[model samples]
Target chain A: MGPALEVKDLCRGFGSRRAIENLGFSLGHGEILGLVGPSGAGKTVTLRILSGILEGTSGTASICGISVASGNRKIYEHFGSVAENHPLPGHLNPFEYLQLRACLKKVRDGRREATCALQACGLLRYGKRYRIGQLSHGHRQLVALADAILGRPSLLLLDGLEPRQLPAVLGELPIRPAVLVSGRNAAEMADFCQKTIFLDRGRVVVDEKREQRN
Target chain B: MFNFFALLTYEWRRISRTSDFFSAGGLFLLLSGLLFLFALLCYVGKPQTVSPFAFWLGHGWPMVLLLVPPLSADSIAGERSAGTLDGLLCASPAAVLLAKFSALLLHYLLLWTVALALQPLALFLASLRLPFPLWSGAELFGALSLLPLSGALYLSCGLFFSTIARTQAQAMAATFVLLFGLLFGPSVLLRFLPACRWPILEDILVRLGAASQNGWPDRFLNFGTVAFYLTATGTILCLSAVFLRSRPFH
Candidate 1:
């Protein structure tokens, strides 16, 4: 596996305190990278920068050769992210929401792709039955997960999923794309990730390499 | 652009399916109903005061001017507030703005079509004549053109405010202030001031065109006002795009 995404000295801050400083890492294609840190370890911030929702104060974050800050009109086409408490439109059922997302992503057959993504995330059953707002918290998370993967984005970023928290759909998250999963638990990160990076304050404290997945 | 149209369709479905038509849209519909009712009331005895053009001149467009901000207030601000703007970041800010405006403008046009049609519909039932060629031919053209032009202007302002305001209510509030200022400011000020003594001042307002009286200037000024409205609308949309791009992620 090789790097599908790379971050070099990424730094972000509000007024005074730097929330993330001198952070550096690379994610390989087909690799599941776990970002493990305590609360405020800047996990969410990093993902935001990569998703181009938040610009970094300094340094660069690029995914699949596309730089987040590059002003590339198609930059977002390559990446999909599910943020913590990601707000899905409450008015739309999960299937409708996915179809809308597919249209936005310009998928060739939007409805079909949406259905496949729902099935992949193990939400096809529930997604068809209820609006996202009507679903349980776990199911909503599943819906969000399904949305991100629907277009088969080359890079996927997910924030705030507890380790193995999505029991019904846990094993269904696609494994081929480069994925960055952020959480607070070390044991949890270690369970699914081939490379687990620990952060304290704003810097990477450890990057542990584990046995390759089967 | 394919990218732009895709977003437009997505927005259209989302809005219609979400039944957004019932919120501010429904309110505007109710107000339009009131305009027709007022027309009907005026028509009962004083048929002379009620023309297809009369009701619109006296009330219909003004009602639209007053009520559309609430409908448009959420055009962009809602997306930003929901943190959904990032999803569309794959396109340029201007492209997104265009698509968003197109979707919202379609929504506005649907409402306007229904509301404006009521003027003619009422005239037909009340007077046995259709409202087309409402005014004289030239005047009719001017009247017809003004409705959409004014709509584009207000919708543009709302889009700009939506881009800047942090919340939907804030967007609507700020847009309402600006809308009323435009609606009431010049006419009220021009009427209130003894400035009528100044020929230049009166000329400016007259050229600006009248919401009162059969009140279009010549064809040139009528076209000019439409041009001015379009320029203003385009300028505001451009500013919003710049502001949207310059702002750090919400």
Candidate 2:
């Protein structure tokens, strides 16, 4: 089988500022890769490009061997994304928000999946009554994580989630999905990631397997 | 169809629950009530009897037009500022814009309905002194026709502003400026020009401004005017969707 997600020669720029330059990476099925970089080092930008939220200036990305440029709805259906700020509709409670995501993803057994996802994220009790805006920052992060995992997407893209929240997420992340997470802290990146790719000024500076790093 | 409804429902819930929505709605109600009371006092205080209720109804719809746009100004722009555009871009850009526009249109419709409901209360108060037709069924229907069209026009403009704006405040300000330009700016310009110059310049400006071409007050309901507004709205909405899709979210 092909890699779960493949990005080659990804270049994205905003006017004079280059967000990412020739960023090439691939993830195998069920692999967890940590993207480590400083602020403005293009980690979030790369994740945005891969998740189909942002178009790169040049290069190609394929999800499950299907090119994103071909208008592959299946690719999006199989992928989940969580950005730095975790922007949920502030009016919706956790349960309503997850349920809406499940419907959008066309998940089978949506209610069951949403409930399980929330419970796994330790957010089941706050499920029915709490709006996203009312939730604490850490809890909001968890909600976004739950949204990413609820549909059991084959590929997951996460940015700016702290290490403390990682335990709640990683401990219960669904199987068969290749996960890519980005952070500025190398220590936190090293903790959960099986492989680490360090970036500097929009280019890859380090790529090491966890075992090699150890 | 299910996806469309689901998106619409989600948007409605999101917008209606915002602090901005409540504040705007409350302001509209307060202003309308004050205007009604003022009209009543003026009529009773006058030597010649006038239909205070009819006067209020005449002024009500135009005031609604002024109010609705501000309520919807930030509909899409807020999403962009909050970094939610990335998540929304996961869906088809066309669908997202259409769904948001529908939600805004629905919000204005509800506001219009509330304004319409107040007409009866005004009429009942007027009935104590004189017999007057406060609202004819035909007039009500006519005004309703224009409400959706005008609301769509404002919403399309707002959507375009949201696509280009970097911040919520900027988007809101742009929306107000555009709306004010469309509604009152032409009349203000006409006031400065002489009558001979006004005829030529006013025609051109009104056509360009998306104003009702038929006449003032009653002419607001003409089919051609409604079509013109709707067509403009559709064109702007299409442009906004394309712009949003082209840029994506980064």
Against the true structure, whose TM-score is highest? 1
Instruction: Summarize candidate 2's per-residue lDDT along A153-188 as a digit string, tens digits.
Output: 888888987756766666676475788899988997
For model 1, the superposed segments whose C-alpha errors exceed 4 Å read: A127-129, A162-175, A211-214, B18-20, B23-27, B36-55, B119-141, B188-214, B220-222
Give model 1 RMSD, 1 decimal: 4.2
Write out fnat for all predictions, comma-separated. Answer: 0.52, 0.55
Deviation in angstroms for A189 in model 1?
1.2
Interface RMSD of each: 2.5, 1.9
**Regions of model 2 farther than 4 Å from truth:** A13-19, A68-73, A162-174, A184-188, A211-214, B37-58, B122-137, B184-226, B248-250
> What TM-scores do the predictions have?
0.84, 0.82
Give the per-prediction TM-score of chain B: 0.80, 0.75
- Ten contiguous residues minimizing lDDT sum, candidate 1 chain A: A165-174
lDDT of 1 by residue, B188-208 (tens): 667666855887666555533
Instruction: Residues A1-214, candidate 1: write the lDDT tens digits.
Output: 3368999999999999888999999987877888989998889899888887788999998888878888775656677788899877776788878887777777779888888888877777876688776888877777888887877777779898665754344355555677899999888788878898899887899888886432
User: B1-250, model 2: which lDDT tens digit per residue?
Assistant: 5456767888898888877777777777667766766665565566244332235344454564566555555667677776666666556778888888898878877876786676567657656432244344664455556556767787788878887776667777888778777766766766675777557566545543433322344555566576677788989989988888776444
